[model samples]
Target: MDFFTAQEQARRQTGRLVVLLVLAVLALIAVTTLVVAVVLYMAGIGGAHSQPQPTLQGMMALLSWELLASVAVGVVALVGLGGLFKRRQLRRGGKAVAEALGGREINLNTRDSDERRILNVVEEMAIASGTPVPSVYVLEEEGINAFAAGYQPGDAVIGMTRGAIRQLSRDELQGVVAHEFSHILHGDMRLNIRLVSLLHGILLIGLAGGMLLRSLRFRRMGGNKRDNSAALVMGLGAALMLIGYAGTFFGNLMKSAVSRQREYLADAAAVQYTRNPQGIGGALVKIGANAKGSALAAPQTAEFSHLLFSQGIKQGFSRFMATHPPLKTRIQRVMPGWDGQFVALKPAPGVTVEPDQSPQSTAGAGGRASVRDNVRASLENAGAPHAGSMATVLSAASVQMAIGAMGQPDQRHVAQAQTVLSALPAALKTAAHEPYTARALIYAMLLSENDAQRQHQLAVLENIALPDVFTELHTLMADVARLDVQLRLPLIELTLPALTSLTIEQAQHFRLCMERLIHSDGHVSLFEWTLYQLLLSHLSEHHGGAENLTLQACERECQRLLSVLAAAGLEQGLESVQERASEMAHALHAAQQVLPFELAAVEDADDMQALSLAVERLRRLKPLQKSLLLQSMARCIEHDGRIRPAEAELFRAIADMLGCPVPPLLGGGTEEQAVLAE
Candidate 1:
């Protein structure tokens, strides 16, 4: 499915979920009212004093309208409260989900070869997909399962089972990660989270019922309570239990209905993305052949079964409760006409140690080389253009089309990613691998070519950063300073996952330090502002709040950002600024035919503050608006028919800020080399 369609589907699914939840709530309220009335009648609340007996008709008469209303209200509150609580608990995004499943975050600096290999595959995929590399975690389960979880691209995390890491080859692993990426790209994570939380809420009634029943078993009924009272309490407990299970039954039906088809789409997308059916299909075949069969051993797997690349938990009800399609059916979809037989696979022999391939190795079947062959794959991938297959000028009629092109994963991207990954500097690549070195590497990029500015920035760092980090900064300064204009942003992109590992306080301090350094020379270059904006926008989780603004609502912000683009493009001494501005205006006008407006003239600002504010506001724009914004930005930059280094950097920074990790323009290799040489 395309990006906008997927987004629309997610919205529709949410609506369906709400309707289902409401129906379930109503059903629960009705059942609870009946149970309450039955218990009360049995307890003799409706019996005559002389008769000492309650008939069914008498009980029906005793069930007041007020009682039913009260029960309905209570039921709604319980379900609503449970959902809200669970949502809050999961609000931390994919990391929380991973942690709940007993996943351990992979340290960037780990020497373990398998961990390093996993990081390589994830990095390549992120670069290929034009997204920030997500945090990766490893679950200790022996099942061959994996998942991607997050509310958005930035907070997303990729999780793998110990079994997945051990059993799947490099190619198979890529395919599985691609499958999870499909979920991430298609906006399935948020809906999945909602489903899990809402299902939990529905199950809360059952849990409460079970608790009451368990309590009744322990509480003695002999002291002061009449037989009917004890029996009524038991009946109430029994009724609650029944109602709770009923809620679960309905919730499972909804979950299955919502989840099963998406699994099929994701599987298809995975094969399409890698252009290698064997990768994902092989993984599935292994799952079937193995005893564990892609089943997660974690207790929490049942909650997020829909998010997994394969079924994470066993479904008791074949077609009704299964979050994913049957393994054989899924395998056949990817690899058609497969006999219903499992393949017996084994680990590669003598692959006990880390591969030692130089940074330049891009050769393998489908760019799937063993770990021993491509130690620098991660960095090289970062250096390459993200979407080299498409011409630098992305073609789109609307914002969604533009974003769809940006977000879609393709086989061409894999080749270009490998090419880019192979060309990175060894030292720069090494620095991006470890947490401490990664920070220093970024500082090195910020350090000026001017000796005075460089020293001033270093002094700010020394005062704010720890002594060790400062020392590392000094050590890596020479290598970082040697980096050319084109490679700088890619290096920063490489550092993002490690930077994300920083504490909130550390991130804040890092943000502050960066601001002081950028302004230290008494001026902010466009490149500096762009770089700072990209770093700070992503590094700070709540950078611009939500992207909830309609295109009409964010008109001013869009104009301001467009003005910045116009100014940046014109700054390169292009002959006619007006002509370029006219071209930009035309692009904006064409892209946003729905909201026709001319480009507002650039308003001067004393500092980069205007551009920063423009970006902050632009973050609030909806996806379609962002598409128009990107198209307009690209038009402004490409008016000269060539993307210069400064323009390319600005473009990348803008894309990253908008949560689109645009690959390096001009497709790396000789083109980038020529720019660096210039």
Candidate 2:
């Protein structure tokens, strides 16, 4: 869960993902080969049969031509289909990412207090781990299922069913969240999504041609009169359809193989993240014993079989299409004595929440809490001495415990959020649009890992919402955390409610994230952090936070990073990795927000001179970073707190030259910092 380990996990996950991509490409190639062979074989047979009066040599030659034509058409059709599916995936996935996060699903209007409580937990985990809080949504279905989805952490999302909300204990729920979070941090989510897109690309070929067969059937029956190229068209259509199908079977095999490994890793990571295999193990067992043991009936479930918490549908072999390992085997790994029966750990009526003693929670019935505390304490003691690294995440038990506990925090995070909500005095409703109330809520959501990170996030908070209210609320970080003056959420939440209003400035408020993290240890560990900040700020200023280019650019950037994190697969799933995931995801999400702008800026530049001028201008903008060129671009553009499409295009070109994937701008596609009043 330390910095280096997270990076290493990312590297490993990325490596595996790259391999999957290679295999997907190979699968497509194999399909193409098969389709061509099939079409050629069939065409040769048909041609040989048609020439009743021909000699053997003439028949052979005619058959060869027929086969060649069929193969040619088939190959083209297959490749075209491959490209089409890739585009479709990117487009669909891109749209899904946008709506999954900054969309209305996570908006204020949709969340009730209970749902908000869960969201509050997610936010706290992200802040603690330093990841972008994956957007969350609720499923009205009565099923007890949950899932994490996204091409990468930055674009990741978590959704829970109503059954999950009402049924599971807080700790058990934590176990579930931790498990899903594990998938996000270890890059399984990206791989899972890739599986979907790759499979789609492979199958679409056959599916496309299959549809065409119907059209060809009509032509064969003389339903049409056009004679030119009729044979050629028919041959082409048949070949393409045949080829498309040949690609599909191999693609499914590849998907199953890659998906299985990731699932095992995710299982281990879930144990590792929670530090209590029993939590996840127990959850799995409960699923089996409960009437609805991961049984999914939705038609769309098959498309996402590998992404579910448990097997939604019972597939043959119970292993091969079953996205997860058998529940019994998983349980044995974590709890040797587990009886395969659900242990009844019901809380007393009013004890829905854990008792407020974390130090004691460490030693309570649930073994996960104490182990997590020990790990955090160990890391904290390592302090400035032991720079957190991938190597630090060891101990079969501790890792598992850490992983499990990671899903749920010690309740303080939730309590704090609750306090923020409760503190809003009745009077605060009168000034519904005050800047400070929004700022206070933002801080409640934002509170970070270390002092420096919190402070840096605070700086980004500057001029964001009710600057004055935030100014007053900012003083509390010292009181609650640094000084431990009060432990109640009410005190923290009550900061400005009676006196001010809450409102959203825009999502671009995160432009300063890289700077905050870069300065985490009182200094930037990597110079890239500064440049990242500069890039976001400049882009946000020129393009509104809602700009498509900005959002696209950031997504692209996070995807590249996800490619990196793909290397990770800890014993824990999303548990403690929460901090690392959230921090990076948020940073990456910021970049995603500005991607569209970056892409246009890169592809549309007319010449090196224009690109250079734009780069130079961007360079001189406020907040210089180690990336000299990035700084230069900032300098070039911020002359008037604006960047026109012309300038945005120029910025895009420079980013390309620098070899950076454009991230979609955070928020929406609008230019950064709209002048809307509270």
| lDDT (CA) per prediction | 0.71, 0.43
TM-score top scorer: 1
Residues 1-678, candidate 1: write the lDDT tens digits: 666457556766777789878887887888799888877766766552213665677667657799899898778887888898998888777888999999999986667777777877887787767677788999988888998988777778999988888888777888898888888877787788878889888788778777777787777778675556666667787887788888888788778777888888888888777767888888899999888878887888888888888878777856778888888899999989678899777853222323222122222343343432243244244544342112233222222322445646665565445554555566667678666788788777777888887877888778887677778887878766655565566567678888888888887777787777877888988778777777776665552355566767767766776656656655445568577666656545443444546666555633478767767777766666665667667765555455556666677678778755554443434433332222
Worst 10 residues of 2 by lDDT: 669-678
RMSD in Å for all candidates: 5.4, 16.1
Residue-wise C-alpha lDDT for candidate 2, range 394-510, written one tens digit per residue: 122221222233323223323222222222332331122233343343343345655676676667655454466566565544433332111122222222221111112333343
- How much does candidate 1 score in TM-score? 0.86
lDDT score of model 2? 0.43
In candidate 2 the C-alpha lDDT for residue 473 amounts to 60
TM-score of each model, paired residue for residue: 0.86, 0.53
| Model 1: per-residue Cα lDDT at residue 368 | 42
